[model samples]
Target: MIEDQLTEDDVLLPTYGPRPVTFTSGAGSWLTATDGGRYLDFLCGLAVTGLGHAHPVVTQAVADQAARLTHTSNLFGTRPVLELADRLRRTLGWDDGRAFFCNSGAEANEAALKLARRHGKHADPQKVHVVALDKGFHGRLMGALKLTGNPAKHAPFEPLGTWATHVPADDPDAIAAAVDDRTCAVWLEVVQGEGGVRPLSEEVLAAARAACDDHDALLVVDEVQTGVGRLGEWYGWQTTTVEPDVVCLAKGLANGLPIGAIVARGVAAKAFQLGDHATTFGGGPVVCAAANAVLDTIESDGLLAHTRAMGSRLAAGLEALAADSPLVTGQRGRGLLRAMTLSGDFAPAVADAALRHHLVVNAVAPDAVRLAPPLNVTPDEVDEALSRLRAAVADVASPTGASPTGASPTGAAPAETDGR
Candidate 1:
């Protein structure tokens, strides 16, 4: 177990509240803890490791690039970056598109917001405000944080520099009412991953598109968590008929490597001039090479089709489980990105129980559990995850079970209830 007893604060910043279990290694759909126990990794690095941990092709590409060239910065061009950019254009179906690379999802969204503001300023100086959906998450950076719709996350860092407004999601009328002449862009997520895995309905998506068109405002879609086949497509926007002017992507872009990108088109593409936006380690050779390998592997191995099939199977299983258990109310989201709504705030307890059963899942909300397993997760592995989840649910729903909220299990089945 490495035998180190030092607390997190002793050596690291107090930015994250990580779990106590330390994993030593991972491969495919499983992770081995430092204590030599293996667990099914459904979290997949918070949807970054879509190809699974330590993927062979990505690992080889990283190794080769490290031996050849690691970083040349934005001062000089690199072949890997150029090739990867070209591939992204084709994959994303952007004919007249431009790409800006960064190190994280927030950076990508920040660049998009900046580009939209610049585009608006170029048209008219009064167009400075941007609109985002309620419950939408952009990033933690200043510009991105201002664009985020969550009030609690923004309350602490008051007086955000950017002039942005938040509107209710799935309501076109609300979007139309909020977006005016001063609005430069409308930020949206096809699926709200952080906000209980809510997917935008087709009518609501159409409303956002129509409103942007009517206002001459840029439609900026954030695909940070739902992009790269997580939603059974290359990009979440591709699932619907609406088109966005700016698309932000990150997370699974490089299969766990730190990479983020913004793809802009038409006026938005021309908004940024030389020195308007740049980054030091945005598209270095190593990460770009890793990203290229990810794209190639996804296409060559047909992970997209696999993701759709597996996602359907997983959703069916979840639906059946919910039908059998009163504790579970319903399910939402698309493809591999799915969530189960609990009757009470038992998500943390269920997650803890799953951990004890040697499985990894995330409590995305107080009453919601999200699942974003690897795209290549085998059917057998998914079956195993379902089994573990059932056991975890049973353990938490037992009559004598310990509840995280210190409340009795109101939805618990009778003592003789059989497994669903």
Candidate 2:
């Protein structure tokens, strides 16, 4: 579809803000716009297209499954669903655990929250309080939103029922104080993806683990953005010493296809009775088949190691950029999920300038420019992105730049720990 005929305003929900560009097609780390212009995609649809766009393996799997079977009621069992679940279990080392499938990160987290609530009542009826960290993002659904620490996103939809408490990000003392016997679960993101690529400190994660152990609360890790090989490891929790009882995953699970799941272990796995939770399209054959292809391709192509090496190259290049550019604050994040803090409110300007240079990026926060390129992105692509990023930053820092404030660029404060 052309840009004018399919503009979001032409026919769609008004919920989404204005988009800078409309894409006609995508392949690998590049996107083709309707205007016949090509742009390097560093955002990867907010890390959704991990295997890159129009991957042969994933596309073939979807086509093959669609011709055979697409959807079936949960009353029947499907091979693809069973195989995908087993693959996830083995991939994450969640031996013998159960998985609940859904359609999005929000749904996956909602299932997790419900499981935690059910498990909480097993001990104390009043243990429904969930502790989350500041800047940690869960999802848009009511239950999951309550677990998120961003009050602005949840303020408009007031009177949320869940009683969730927020603690300072990476603060051990705050986490220790908030999680206690009254708390039913501690929900956290090992690496805050939406909050601006901030990784939680090991100290705070350890404290949360200890607190959950002491209070008998379920330790839940929201790996929605950090899981499925986004963080070099299969899951971000693997990088940390803490192992969670419940793990949430969604983004990139089926490449571009929508799929979410909650992997629960031990007693937590039994929290939901047969009739308590269900989803019609959660583990549909087509999506599961596509998921299997994604996993297979990741393993066969050695994308994890590629992702690690590419991530290191990106980080080193960004650090070098920081040394030369006064507008750059510092570098933060891991693997392909990374961000650079910009001086002033110049992130949007930098993103705009990047678009002018045929590059796509995301200004997640006022000062944060996030880059979550595909896992299979090559070293050459990483270098090209960095080169474009430098030019974008330079343009934004120019005297007649695109800064909203139009003030001289002042370096961002050295507070690298600001979660998200």
Top candidate, metric lDDT: 2
lDDT of 1 by residue, 194-297 (tens): 87789998887888888788888899999999888888889888888888998999999999999999988887889988888889899899999999999999
Q: What lDDT does model 1 reach?
A: 0.86
Predicted candidate 2 versus true structure: per-residue lDDT over 1-420, tens digit per residue: 575467678888877766767799999999999899999999888789999999999999999999999888788998999999999899889786889899999999999998998999888899899999888899888988888889888889989975899999969999899887889899999999888789999999999999999998999999989998888988899978999999999988999899999999988988888788998889999999999999998888898888889999999999999999988977899999999877666676777778888989877777888999999998999999999999989887776655442223553423222122
Least well predicted 10-residue stretch by lDDT in candidate 1: 411-420
Where in model 2 is the C-alpha error above 4 Å? Answer: 1-6, 403-420
Error of 1 at 285 (Å): 0.8
Candidate lDDT scores, in order, read 0.86, 0.87
Model 2 TM-score on a 0 to 1 scale = 0.95
